[model samples]
Target: MSALRAPASPGTRPAAAPRRAPLTSLPGGAADRGRRLDAVRAPLQATSGVPFLVLCAVILAGALLAALLLNTSMARGSYEASRLQAEVGHVAQDVQSHQEKLRAAEASLAERATRLGMVPAEDPTMISIEKRAKVGVGEADAGADATLGP
Candidate 1:
């Protein structure tokens, strides 16, 4: 059987349009120069996703670095606080030791007074004077006189 070609209708269309040369291929003109300049600046004009991602990455990195620095500063402060607490504890221990030594010294002074023939009086005498009084104004007792050395 012979293959028959179909007749073209009045409104039939071609398979494809004719290819034309780009505008830049033509002679130099304002429009062509503009197109050339646009071509040159197109890459710069159209933003790429990489720059956005890079900006986000930079911001994230900066935030992380700031957090790290803040945490480091806080850790240093904690360390300093711990050191100060330890120092306070050591100072408190020293104060306690000094207080104990003072108590011992006071006891030793009391013992030394007793050894030096000083007796603690059971009844303490108080003589109040509004103005200066003459020496030996208080009444003398035999026990007081006996306590004094001859």
Candidate 2:
């Protein structure tokens, strides 16, 4: 049987060993201790509230500025409206003054015509330019009009 022991198969290949990560520093530079090392990290620091406060302040200032501009615009518009109302009142006064003057002038004209002995014609006559003749005899006066009393 020792002589009959099977020879190693020539057709079979040997399996490769599993790959492993190389060890870095371990206390005294120990190798292959089979322990994973923890990674070092930066320490946590406290953040300041100044940047947030500044942002809030800027937004508040912008809102105030917008409100100021809106108020100014409203005030300007109010001033313009008041000015236009005053101008309208002035125009109305001017128109009324002109109307009063016209009335006075009309009355003056009537009185002047009476003083100049210009009387209203009872039987009005017209010379027709187109026909080149007198339109009527015009000798009769107010007798045919029923509205006139004898």
Task: Put down candidate 2 lDDT per residue, 75-143, tens digits, no spaces.
Answer: 999999999999999999999999999999998997899999998777776656666555653667333
lDDT at position 28, candidate 2: 48
User: Model 1 segments beyond 4 Å from truth?
Assistant: 1-44, 114-150
Structural similarity to truth (TM-score) of each candidate:
0.46, 0.44
lDDT of 1: 0.74
TM-score top scorer: 1
lDDT for residue 20 in candidate 1, whole number 0-100:
100
Q: Against the unseen true structure, what C-alpha lDDT does each candidate score?
A: 0.74, 0.78
lDDT of 1 by residue, 1-150 (tens): 258867778899757988997755556765765653543344657666998899999999999999999999999999999999999999999999999999999979978999999998664444335433233433544235322222
Worst 10 residues of 1 by lDDT: 141-150
Worst 10 residues of 2 by lDDT: 141-150
